[model samples]
Target: MSPTPQAVYLNGEWCTSDSACVSVFDRGYLFGDGVYEVIPAFAGRLFGLDEHMARLSRSLEALGIVPPLKHDDWLAIFERLLASTDAPDAAIYLQVTRGAPAKRDHAWPDASVRPGVMATVSPIGAIDGGARVITLPDERWGRCDIKSINLLPNTMARQQAVEQGCDEAVLVRDGLVMEGAATNLFAVVGGRLLTAPNGPRILPGITRGLLLDLVRRKRLMELDESFISIGALREADEVFLTSSTKDIWPVVEIDGEPVGAGEHAGRAGPITRLLDRHFQALKTRRSDP
Candidate 1:
């Protein structure tokens, strides 16, 4: 195996990953008072960069944290960081915290403190296969839309899935499926694609938006942004998850049971394959001049 990339950008300065550090009193460290966005780069091009930035801005606004850099400034920083890596396919992680306070207090600190900014790049390999998923109760806070750094609940759920030999966890709240621990969920029921409507319960994922657009344009199937009950999902013809790193991964098995109709059960269904194909084509087209 090759060594990991070490390039990182911290507060407008370039440094190695080992040299980067943040204040212990930083609000993000103390109270998870921060927001982040992950963008995938293909052939040196950052995919859905504008959308991700817009979402990041919204996350900061929701948390009442001022943006530390302008949009163009962020673009330049990401460009510089990406140029430092030789990997054609990479994932860029950008984060902003409310900054370190004079003292560790529960209350908001003075606005004079500058927000902490950090970014890093890592090589990403192609996704090779389907994923086995498990369902768990959604235990996150109400502001799931904020994309804040408070991901303890998410981490726990993902850990549970991993312990069960699964790739992801579909979080259900009150019998209704919200999303995956770190991804957006989609189910095909009766030939219609259904997903949880974006609200306070779920993060509006950029890849989810892009897939919705592609589905509409291709007219592959009926699209519905609505609630998906646990029962409905179990009875669905297909299930899939979407994220920036994992484009569109089909869920072949959920909680040890096969997904999809009997004849084509326990495998990536037809619609799932179709969407994956279209998604790859999308990447190819976007990578072209």
Candidate 2:
């Protein structure tokens, strides 16, 4: 029941969260015509800043919306927002919408209308335990590659998982395991790593990319960027999900059934522990000079 943070950046101005508001006619409000990025910062150092910005640019370009600020402008804004928070680790949320139009129309607005930009900072919370996931139908739009503000489908799926006393929702489309509600899915099958390939059906998460890099660097296990069948996932030895906020989390249970096999059955497996150790080392390296 604690109060929400009051520091927010809206349209080139520093304002209280209560005072931050966009026009009702904004396309983002009317039709979710916007894109967003969530950048994580530890001890005020923003991780994957360039990569997140690159993805944001791609999302805006895909939607035909102009970026409101330059790269340096965004860096400055993020610095200011991070300074407003006292937490050692935090997440910065930046959003850009196609501005309000003179009238609500199905078509694009006039070229003169500037895009609406907003940002906020919140403390990053720790993941206390392994995830319990529920497999749900992937009913989102086709353009999942673009980080659009339209997340109703994801919200619904996550809510359903929570209602069932679960921590995450693994989305299955056409018998293929796509991803989680907000995280990318990965599984260990036959002593190899398997995950859905990068495509329109997935977001190409930044953390996911980093993990792939680590996997290749250490040659930890055979990695395959391919579709994992739902049947394969259910029978996998270990299951995990990754994201910017929750770097990597093991899936101990799915739909109330345990994951993995043999000695590690129903527990975080050896491979998961190894990858997590590498991830921690990566974080520590990032914090170093």
lDDT of each: 0.91, 0.92
Point out where model 1 deviates above 4 Å.
1-5
The CA root-mean-square deviation of candidate 2, after full C-alpha superposition on the true structure, stands at 1.1
TM-score of each: 0.96, 0.97
- lDDT by residue (108-199, candidate 2, tens digit) is 98789999999999999999889999999999999899999999999999999999999999999999999999999999999999999999
RMSD of each: 1.5, 1.1
lDDT of 1 by residue, 34-137 (tens): 99999999999989888899999899999889999998888898898889889889999989999998889988888998898989888888877788999999
Task: Give model 1 RMSD, 1 decimal.
Answer: 1.5
Provide the lDDT at 135 for model 2: 100
